[model samples]
Target: MGDYTDKVKTKMEDLIENEKNQWIDLALKIHENPELSFEEHKATQWLTEPLEQAGFRVKRHLLPELPTSFFAEWTGTKAGPTIAFIAEYDALAELGHACGHNIIGTSAVSAAVSLKKALDDDLPGKLVVIGTPAEEEGGGKILLVENGWFDDIDAVMMFHPRDKTMIFRGSLACVDVDITFMGKAAHAAANPDQGISALDAMLHSFLAIKQLLPSLPASANVHGIIRKGGDATNIIPDHCEASFLMRAKTREELHSIKRRVYDAVRHSTKAIGASCTMEEGLIYAERINNRVLGYQLMYNLERIGVEVDSSEITTGIGSSDIGNVSQLVPTIHPYIKIGNAITHTPAFTEATKSPEGMAGLIQAAKALALTAFDLFQSPSLIMQAKEELRQTINQRRNRL
Candidate 1:
């Protein structure tokens, strides 16, 4: 079994290598045409084009609201585990693919295509590639999970390009709060006393939250930006809006933080004789990296001659929609080292199309394909992974 697995892995790697140029071109093209979240129509079309040509059955716009999202599947001759690859293609506003999503989306496509070619008609299980959009701002995966898109998948996997290569990392559970304050508007020179300044209330809220942060836990934090401050300095502002993103180690902790911050906003607005309302986005749950699958990925990564770094991510964590998907199925969002520059920056944007970036992309594709091959060849691994996910979920529920 080990020998056959090795041969299959070799074939998969060869397939990726032989067509590395084409894959590189695709990644570069995606980098050139950067699209924002939920508006990745071109990216969706480009990503699925190769899959459809390779004989995978394609479905576009799984959800009416999420029109850019899609699903492509290939069924085997026999019944087995269904493994799905999650693809993210949304770019940041103004930064234009600075987050390396171009690398991410293309790597998933290359991996799935190579794996299918290596196995051919001998595949024993189902393979699917899910195109998930709006990850940067909107919770695209959260919507898909709620709609039952991932209900039948046995395992899910995706790769992220980072400064370091790690298999297991923790992410914060997060939610965005949009706060709006309303007050009476009046001319500053004519009757300043008659006007209630909404900007004052917004500023007070920021101060109040800053004061509250010291009392909160180290793992919890709140960052905010003023979406609408005022129209002009000569006139008293009538309306103001501030957006805050609160994050914590877990959703429970995040909830507590939100309550405190909401209280602060209310009190601050009331003190300034203004009324305020808060709107929140979907809650992004903390990540639960399936140890069973993560270890398999680590092994395969090393087999491809890429050195494995520490498997545990203890600090410097952020939130992602993948965290929501990890809650349902055995999932791994492993990171491959692209360069020293971090994500969401101009330097990182350049690295996504650089030679080093291309190397990381190919490495990521090979590792993903090989690890997926492991799941198809060894069903016990899938069972163990699912059991691990069950235990983790139960433990989280007990804590709550």
Candidate 2:
């Protein structure tokens, strides 16, 4: 077993060195050309082209309904334990790869490619690379999972870029909603009393939420924007729309908070004599990290000289599509730090493309590939992971 582990390590090291330039170039290309969620045509092509060229049978699952979203798979000759690597290529709106999705695409692809190269000699499992889209808004992984995309996979793994490297305990709750208020439009000056202002309803909703903040838990968050307001200045606007994102520590807590939010909106609109309509957008559950798999990743990372402090286990609150994936299967989404800059900002964008970012990319690829290798090689670890997931599912069912 030790000999086999060493062989895999040697193979990964060699593959990293050999494919360094290719991976870096891929990252830069994706970074240079950013595409928004479900609109990543060029980015998807760039990601899958290299894999297709490397003799992997590339299959695309196109939802004609969803043009920008796709699924790519590569099956190995021998199938023991199916290991999956997930890739995200969709960038933020107008920000390009500011969230460092280019690095994410590159790192996942590199891990899959490296694993493929290692398994060429004696294949023990099937390697699947799934291209998930619209992680920023639509919870693309949740959609894919609901469509039965991750049924047979034994385990799922993906790494994200952050300001530090650590195994996170869990993620926060996320809920997206769209609210619209409808009122009668009339002349603002001549018939001010005859018109009901939708803008006033929105303002009242905001104020009501602000007043409710003291009642909300520390972990809960309520933030939003008025996407649409009155069009004309002299006339009262008939319709106004707003979007909100509410987050909390648990799914139940988020639901509770959502109910209050709905009541607030309803009452606010009612106070202004306007009708209100609310539509639920996307609801992402908190991530429950598989502790056994997370520890295995930490072990593999340590073997590769990546020092992750135990104190770094508890990270900040953020939501991800991978959180949705975690509920369906045993998964790990470890964050690897490239620099001290926070994500979703210009500084993060600049740091993500810098030399330090490239180096972190390689290190992240190495860690992910090695972790996959460990899962492939150790049946005990695989059983441990499966058992952990089974217990979690059972516990949730029992509580229900």
Candidate 3:
């Protein structure tokens, strides 16, 4: 395989290296001007500029609901499998680029662009770069999948910038919920007996969740904060709102957790003579990393001198919209080490544009490009990937 594929790998590496400065600058520019989810206008513009220049038929705001979302593709003359590089460019609210998504988006477009440059018109497959926004707040990829954006794509590839480079890190299935309680208000001291305190209902709900925690499965997690408690201490609170996120290792477990937790919240509100209303965010399914493609990517990463820690791959993980994408198609969301600083911190934000982060960016680009080439170069590999994905989906459906 080395003798057969060394030429393609060399060309991929060369293409990435030749345009390293441009890609690195793109990452830096995005890091310098951070945007929140669903609002990545500048980041989207900067990332897609090079793709359009490289002759990709870029489609901006592909999803009507998400104006920042985009789909860019460069089709070869010959018909072949469609391989997509998913790009995420959303930043944390206050911490800016703490999650290192700047690198994720940059590396994806860099890979797609590099592959276009290296393979040119002789490329056997169709290449696409999806400018997916809002991995941090909204589930942009989830929306895309629901709207039939990935229906035609055969396989998808992308890497995340993290503290440790893991080959097959998994993400928990998660959902965000907002609970509101309504009650009657009165002066605290003057007419305490006449008021029904919404704050008390909210407090009871929190206690109910904490007390129920020990009984839940080890993988279950419920964390939240009081978004609105009261306007003034002198009056009995008439309205309150709290937001919470629930997570589990799989979507099945998540359903059970949500049922029990929501029941507890409802009973608590009823006990307090308060009416409750709840709203939920998109459900981020547990990630299913395609092993056949994962190993193929591991080969490329190794060839580039980047050591992949396969053992700790499942260790530290949160939720992301990519989890939804994995459920639909063969996907891999590997992580590359930039620094010891964990994600969503000021330290992590600084490390995004650090020299180490840039190094990860370049290696990720080459590996992604090479992996895409590996699939396009051989029909057997694509068959194996599609088969694995089919079996995984069937198994999941059986579980359901």
lDDT of 3 by residue, 155-191 (tens): 9999999888887888899999999999999999999
Model 2 vs. true fold: TM = 0.91
**Residue 279 of model 2: what lDDT?**
90
Cα displacement (Å) at residue 121, model 1:
1.9
| Consecutive 10-residue window with the lowest summed lDDT within model 2 | 308-317
Write the residue-wise lDDT of candidate 2 on 2-89 in tens digits.
Answer: 8878987888878987889999999999898888888888878888887776655566655553465555556656667888878888
If scored against the real structure, what TM-score would every candidate get?
0.94, 0.91, 0.94
Please give the CA lDDT of all the candidate structures.
0.93, 0.82, 0.91
TM-score of 3: 0.94
**lDDT: worst 10-residue window of model 1:** 307-316
Assess the local accuracy of residue 325 in candidate 3 as a C-alpha lDDT between 0 and 100.
Answer: 91
lDDT of 1 by residue, 1-400 (tens): 4788889999999999999999999999999999999899999999999999988999999999899999999998888899998899989888898888998899999999999999997888999999999999889999999999999999999999988899898898999989999998999999999999999999999999999999998898799999999999989999999999899998888989999999999999999999999999999999999999999999989888898784588688899999999999999999989989999999899888899899999999999999999999989999999999999989987988
- Which candidate gets the maximum lDDT versus the true structure? 1
Which residues of candidate 3, in runs, are more than 4 Å off?
2-4
Candidate numbers sorted by TM-score from highest down: 3, 1, 2
